[model samples]
Target: QVQSNGTALVAFEKATGKVRWAIGQELASYTSPLVVTMHGQKVLLYFARGGLLAVEPRQGKVLFHFPWRARIEESVNAANPVVVGSRVLLSECYGPGSVLLDIDQQWQPRVIWSDAGKDRWDRSLAAHWCTPIYVDGYLYACSGRETPEADLRCLDYNTGEVQWVQKRTGRCTLLFVDRHLLCLNEFGTLIVLKPNPQKYEEAARYEITDLEYPCWAPPVLSDGILYLRGRGRLVALELIPSRK
Candidate 1:
């Protein structure tokens, strides 16, 4: 486990209570520490107010630390960092926008690109629980800062450029199946849109009969199954129609 005293980052072994490593730097944060493995090396990812920082797990050596000028409310990131191939996707809602970083052979970090549009729209940064998705050659994300308004957007993974934007969607909880983007609204309604660059084309949609308010959650798609939750209840749905 990793613990921060605000001025220092510390990692410990739970079972043996051994102190694996310790690094110091005060960062405002309400975000969680994420454990990741890159290039076969274990690393801990942390959003320490100033910016995103990556450190070696076993040795507790910081791989790279990039500083940004943006400030996050409560020092929180609504989403987690999505690692793809050689780069990591870092996004914040409040004006700092998003950045794509390339990790070098020496573990140094390089800024591939930046997007100011990724910042908070209506003001709240951590609006949704859904993290950014890097699938195919694009990154899928949702923004719903103003009202219950949401925008389902796609961006190029290698370029950090927006592929397309689908507007007028409510607070969207997102999922993917067979390369399709599946989403949910504040209600129990569902939407299916193609993650395309040319245009927005919806392939399918459905609504939950009695599923009511605060369906403000994202659906999970797995192995041809779809799971939804609302009003403290969980329901499983079939993604594909029955063979019979």
Candidate 2:
């Protein structure tokens, strides 16, 4: 279990709840750890306060460490690292907008490109906590630090070039499935849109008026039912029609 305030990461055995291994006296952001295979080796990445660390999952060995933190005092490393090929993309709204890193076979990280060097909105995708989903060489995401200024954006993932931006969707968390982007805004509104970098084509919208205000959790799709978390309740809605 990773501490909420970013101090220490503890791994536990599922059945017995025994502490398997605990590593680091490091600080972490609000984002969670991601396990992925890099350069043909399975490694765990923790975006900590000091930097990004690649650790051996089972034995708790630090393989490589990459320093990355927002320069602004109020800023944080909240977005989860998006792994592209042998590269990883990190972005935050407060500090540098976005940075692309190339990881070689030796597991060394080198910054290849950075969008934060430009303006905030000019970056690939400046997100608060909404992690952009990359598909078909493009990225679809909610870009901005606050709700009023947030925009639904599509960008070229490799070059950090903006394709299009739609301002109506306010600070959304999105999930991509079946070539469609399922976006859930902070207002608890669900919107379905086509995943296209050329333009924004919204298919439909469903608003949950009964739910309490500020639903920031990302919508979850399990089996055929869609789950939405509100103030204090869990809502389950069946998205697929029953076969009768």
Candidate 3:
């Protein structure tokens, strides 16, 4: 658990709720911690306010720390790090757009590519809060800080090259299931998209009635039911057709 003071991450025992280990004085960010296997070892990656902290899960020892944050005071590291094999991608809508880092054998981070230069819109991705989804060798995400500037874009994961952009999608969250992308925009509009790197290919769209705007929460899928939450409402829709 992240401390309320944003100064530490505490690990608690599941049954007794006892403190297991606490490490680092780095400020916490909204991005959640991710556990992945790297080089035949388990690594815990946390994108704190300072940057990405790679830690050993069992002993709570810090392995490596890479500084990757914006220069502004009000900026945040909201998007969770996207990891594929030995490389990890960190993205934000602030000054630093996105960076791809390659973690080598010694747990050292080396910059593969960075799009944190001029021409923000031309960068691969500048996601505000939604984490980019990795599929095959591409990335799919809504790139922008605000609603008016938001665009659903596809990018080459390795080279940080923009493949395609679907304009005016607004700030949205995505869920990939059954080889299809389920997008729920901030304005309560749900869109089904076929994941294609060459162009924007939408399969279907629906305006979820009675669901208010500012739908920042990502859609949840469970047992063939799609759950959507908006201001003052929670909706559940069945996606799989009944066999009857």
The candidates, ranked best first by TM-score, are: 3, 2, 1
Model 3 per-residue lDDT tens digits across residues 58-157: 8788899998888887888899999999999999888788999999989999999998675876778898899999999999999999889999999999
Query: After superposition, which runs of candidate 2 have C-alpha atoms over 4 Å from their true positions?
Result: 1-7, 13-20
Alpha carbon deviation, residue 103, candidate 3 (Å): 0.3
Off by over 4 Å in 1: 1-40, 72-75, 116-128, 222-224, 240-244
- The candidate that achieves the highest TM-score relative to the unseen native structure: 3
lDDT of 1 by residue, 14-46 (tens): 999877677858465545678876777777887
Each candidate: RMSD = 4.0, 2.6, 1.8
Cα error, candidate 2, residue 161 (Å) = 1.0
The number of clashing residue pairs in model 2 is 2
Model 2 — TM-score against the truth?
Answer: 0.89
User: Residue-wise lDDT of candidate 2 within 57-163, one digit each (tens)?
Assistant: 89888778877666756667777888878888887787677777888887788887787467665677787888889998888888888888999998887778889
**Candidate 3: regions farther than 4 A off:** 1-7, 242-244
TM-score of 3: 0.95
